[model samples]
Target: MSTFSRLGGLLLAAALPLGAQAELPAERIEPSIHAELAAHTRHFAQQIYRVAGNVHSAVGWQLGNVVMIEAPEGLIIVDTGESVSESRKIMAEFRKLSDKPVKAVVYTHFHPDHINGVQAFVSREQVERGEVHIYAHETLLQNVVAQGALVGPILGVRSAYSFGSFLPASDQEGMNAGIGPLAKAEPSSFIAPTVTFGERLDTRIAGLDVQFLHVPSEAPDEIILYLPDNRVLISAEVDQGPTLPNIHTLRGTRFRDPVQWVESLDKLRAYRAEHMVPLHGRPVSGQDKVEEVLRMTRDGIAYIHDQTVRWMNKGLTPDELVEKVKLPPHLAGYTPYLREYYGTVKHSVRQIYNGYLGWFQGDPVALDPTPPRQQAERLIALAGGREKLLLEAGNAYLKGDYQWAAELAGYAIRVDHDDKLAREIKARSFRKLGYASMNINWRNWYLMSAMELEGKLDGDAIRQRSVEMREVFLSPDMVRSFTPQSFLQNWVTRIDPQKAGDLELTLGFSFPDVDEQWALEVRRGVAQLHKGIPEGTELRLSMDKRFMETLLTGEGGLVKGALLGDVKVEGNLLEIRRFLACFDFADEAFGLTLR
Candidate 1:
């Protein structure tokens, strides 16, 4: 059976029956803040003719529209949609625009929504036919590979929260209120580029003079392309309206450099183009409008940055900063472009602190902390009883004091796990929190956690679909940064002193389509991975790229999978097992506590 099947069966067996008791219907999500979707809708409708191509993203995500430029020599495709299915939709629309084949594809960045769907426009064979070129910033490839290694599992889990992927399409459950609709289309087979450049690359393609500017702040590998003749600037993913950047995505990843993100906006201001197209939202036309939007975006970031730094310098904690900071009236109103949809100012401020100070607030007390459960149990006893705590939390929830309600209810649940009333009250508090959040990630997390508590967990059947890892290609440097964190927990557990220097194994990983290979070495208790196979290696574990991923992720146990004949182990089997035994399983349950 497939890995998905085995995991699915196990989860399903453990799942609380859907009919155990109907969960209280999800409350209507209130739009606490304005969003950019409305403005984009109006703008796109007004400029439909200028739109060269468009694609429907999927059932649960916003639809992606593309504008293609056909020049005398070839074609320039902009803003590839989310995945293979979404890309096909774009191609179908491309047919409507013009029959010219795509000569080159320009990626805004490596975001799944923008770069995952390029294959629909042209085949790998056609690109190799020397008829097409894929263009992106120098860092784009690096970001793609780094993100690809973990995107599957992180997206697989957090996607459930962001897109309501497992929620049924019913009125009370899976309504597309959060991140609009999620793109449910199948992921495309990834295709890596045959060409790349540093700093800037000025090239002519499809009869258009394309000037690529490297912006490494928002995305280390992001590029903003300029069409000098058309006076159009493809802003890529950098300037997606005025909402705060998803600096620290809840779905999980390294912290984005917000300071550099501000710098990227300044770089974009130099373009002074008449038309600007973002990867996720509506395009801007006219120099004045583009400038206005860009200026506001810059100011928005500045406002957050300045205030955060001022407070940080004054020795304010993240919690104090969140409570004290507020946007000026000029920055407060809801503009479709400035709405907090994906990220919010409050969270962004916290991220800025984290990025600069590295989580230590210069407070020695914070260096070590008491465990949350132990503290919660003591607090519950001080509160008299779990029932009293639940009642108080429920009262607070009804009074719009969701933060306190959540805290108290959490303590009650921690104190008495079997207290169904406490769980119900806590879940209800989470529901309310979800209803009031403007950030889609926050809403999904709050709501999804509530759903799981109420015995309505969405199954993981969707992860079965195969995704071409190479399509979301990564650069060598990015791969190195990614491997350590992705497998840190597992690696830490598998180390054994007796076997420290007893094993030296080399494994080759190949992705034929992308023409990439990496040599992974296990020496002593440490793992050293490189671009090619190392010399005189005791073991040569050759395998498909995806299989290596499965092993790395701990989704497929190395020893068990090898024993089951799913993975090939060519060296000393005993050493391989010994090496595998060093890694420890991550306990996700720890996150549930307050600590």
Candidate 2:
């Protein structure tokens, strides 16, 4: 479980076509959509553009772009990249252009693609020594630490599916990840910021007049960098490259308020800079071109936001709004940037509906419906029989009604989870729908779900792969960025109630090297973490800082270390085992997909 599983390549080689009708019908892939995605290959090809003056953007090197602003004495970098390995390649090329030391590093947002490459530019020692300064929004640190918290496990799975991590690296399948090329690995290097600003900050970095504004868009802590004297605007994710902006991402995100995104775009437009550099795609020069892109990007966001609200106000359900709300003809074809390669109006409209009105759309019938499997069983009965229902599904698939066929197959599956025929029919429908999808996320999710349904992927294997993603995400450098307090705080949910519910115990921890003392108190099913050691404790254990780091990074095990004399123990060493036993490390049943 330490390496990413390439499940697509491991697919059963002798697997048969999903059903007897697999070759009966032609696919309905839109030629224009396919061509549009293909054309973006050129847009994201590896290259570095001299945006304007001393500002250069290295695009297509990783999922997020990196910008370098040169100064007479040093260089300023914004958004490192997805990983140390990927950024090292780009850093080599950047060095050929400038020989100055990196004076400061700034992050556009807290997304991994933008921050994981920090060590490639400068080390933590340099920052600690006051030689290099790291700049970011004040809220960025909290979000970065949250990556290892409760929701992290599931977020990793959803992100991998959206990024096509499990798909083959071929032109027909995983050609382009829509944002940038997928990284070979998710290795990360994180450093806490040295300088953080709240809403806005104006200062001089490397002798350039710099302004950072907290504009919430793609990410909560998103900040745009503007050089007042250089007249250059670095429009981070605020202007997500040449595609329909993902006002709402399929890979689940913080509440992305469409209106707030539009407002943030307005904030960028106020700069009136002559040059605009976006993190995902090419840079734009000239006031007219920059303004057009900014306006179109914001207008596209506003159109989706307004229209969804319009229909939602009419008592329309989310499904109904999906049918009713659409972009006007002008906006739909306005610019290539508005193309639905990354985000589609279909998904965007649904999120807006949920934001305004909750999951229940005033439908009392949905309050307490029959359980899923029972309802599906009744559906099979209503359709005369299982064979007849499966037959109807095959007929619909042959007629190119893939969605309806998939729905029917789903009911059949809900009746019996292991119906081979029903699974095959559903997998067939998913393959068709995947190839016909207009957005990258939709296409990838559909294709991945098909793989899961066809027995090409094993549940146990997928679960292990998802769990291994933690190693890449919480790399050694990332683990080092956490304070003992923050690191142990994420483990609060892992307390085993069955073991610790009736027991009351306090365990003291001392790290003499780091001069940090912490304690964990378990009382009646509740676990409390304290920054300082409690006054009285039943057991006390001291650990070297280096040994503690190894434990956090998964380099060693706690029980093994205690037995190996790597940990200092006092007051009944067996109590160490008792404390460790109170936590649950057993893997849960859910993983990448619930079905």
Candidate 3:
């Protein structure tokens, strides 16, 4: 049987009957609502759903939902599908409804899935030439560049694990991404917004009067749109799917202000939208239901945030508050929409605490606690070392006490990474834990951890491969804006001092296309940049700005460029090669669950 079947069987065996009076442990009980609703793709996938008057949504075509508003002149596209190919498919189906030219595009947020597919609807030249306009929050560009360019290498892999990026597109493993279907990992065709707004912007585009509200919810750069004519509200990530809002996502990011998130929900509620279209998932029609969902979502967030603060005032720690602050029975409605598919109550509670109180948990012991490996070693020693711990962990796994088994095996493996038996036991434990998890993100992470332990998943390989692809795919426009000094400073700080070995080299680069010139001087693992070529440059390299961009982007790579006549060298090739080799740029991947 497949792992999914085995897991489902195990879950069924462990879980109590629905008629039972007592509550099953959160770990054992599968969230029926999430499995039922998130997996209900047949109802809308590949269908142009008429959400409300003149509004249509193409759901399940990609990671992000595409909503089209038919206006007098053309269609106002909101949050294009995740990729150019994805948008092509979605828009093909969308065109069956209407073939109007896209007058404007509104980016709901800076998330790649929401904004990267702009090239599909309109050409970059049109957007650049002011023929077509794209609007987004003022901070969207900076936020996108920061997340996609600066920290993309790290975020890319973490996101891969969280979203089951590498997992096959099947219900047996990776099926749905809480908000939408599995994201296709294709090259993102990101077109920067031509217009930006702050706070709110009321504008008429495509002969449709719309109100854009800058509501920072899932992302600080997020926004929602309201069409007064249709009484429709396009809630971007705010209502991304029906799942409980991910106030805190597993992929690391800045802490989301629960207070601000709640306020954003309120702003949407004020619209009293008869038809509510989310950036993901299906839309909701009927003024009453929309109002109810809006209110319930707001209340849920407020309950978590307000109660977390209330308990914190009583000196309750985050851990304590997470357990104590659950939705009251009256407020915890039995709606599939309110279920924790992406975010759980405990995590939301903790995030609420973190938003107010930083990572310091007030315990000095925690402030200077023993390192994880050392603590594991000490624990293993106390428990009769690796063999004893592995044996106990194995016993626990056999008894279906996966949490305990994983805990014991974790300690044993941490103390001695070569403990093969412990690693196998821990992998089994995590597999069970993953199978039992209601949150898909947790399930993916747990299963990924199990795979990592078994050497099935190579996080390092993924990171390194991602680095190469990202380097080539990163926009040249963004890279060109980087000043020589800033670029050199960043590389210099990352240089390994011990790798210097008394080597000193200088290289000059001239880019005629952009009229930019810079020279690099390296000594003892330290590097400095000079504007224009310095008089005593040991070697000189000249190339078109586009060629330089390609070299930096790893297009043909440096060696290939030199051999292919893409780059010209005026000095010794060995010297240039040696100079390039001096910089240590090894890709390093960090452990997630293992640590």
Worst 10 residues of 2 by lDDT: 5-14
After superposing candidate 3, which stretches have Cα over 4 Å from the reference? 1-46, 168-174, 459-493, 497-545, 556-584, 589-591
Q: Mark the 10 consecutive residues where model 1 has the least summed lDDT.
A: 52-61
**Tens digit per residue, CA lDDT, model 3, 1-595:** 5545654443343232222122211233232223554454443365667876698988878878888889999988898776788898878877888988888888998776786677788887887788789899988777755665556667766776786554433423435666777676666667777788899999899888999989998999899989898798999988756677788988778989888888998889888889998887788889999988888888888888888899999999987997799988656653556667778889888877877888888889988899999999888789875556655665676578988988887886676665555666677777777766667788788777776776666756677646644532355544543444434444564556676558787889887766878888888878877788888776988777666546445565667777788878889987888787777656676556566
Worst 10 residues of 3 by lDDT: 16-25
**Residue-wise C-alpha lDDT for candidate 1, range 1-595, written one tens digit per residue:** 5544543432232233322122332344332322343332333231223522321112222334455777676567765666667567656755765777778887766666666566778777887787888776666655665455534444445554555444444412333332224454444455566567778899888776778888865567788777787678777667764355565667655767767777888888888888887655566788999888887877777788889999999999899998877777676664755666666788888988988888888878778866777888888778775545655665675677877877886775665554455566566667777666666667667766776665465232323312222223332222322332243323433445465566765555444434565665667777665765556655545444455556554466656666776666567766555555544333222122222
Error of 2 at 439 (Å): 0.5
Candidate lDDT values, in order:
0.60, 0.79, 0.73
User: Against the true structure, whose lDDT is highest?
Assistant: 2
Candidate 2's C-alpha runs over 4 A off are 1-33, 171-174, 498-501, 504-508, 511-518, 530-534, 544-546, 565-579, 588-594
TM-score (C-alpha) between model 3 and the true structure: 0.82
Query: What's the TM-score of each model vs. the native?
Result: 0.78, 0.88, 0.82
Tell me which of candidates 2 and 3 scores higher on lDDT. 2
Ordered from best to worst lDDT, the candidate numbers read: 2, 3, 1
Predicted structure 1: lDDT: 0.60
Model 2, residue 33: what's the lDDT? 34
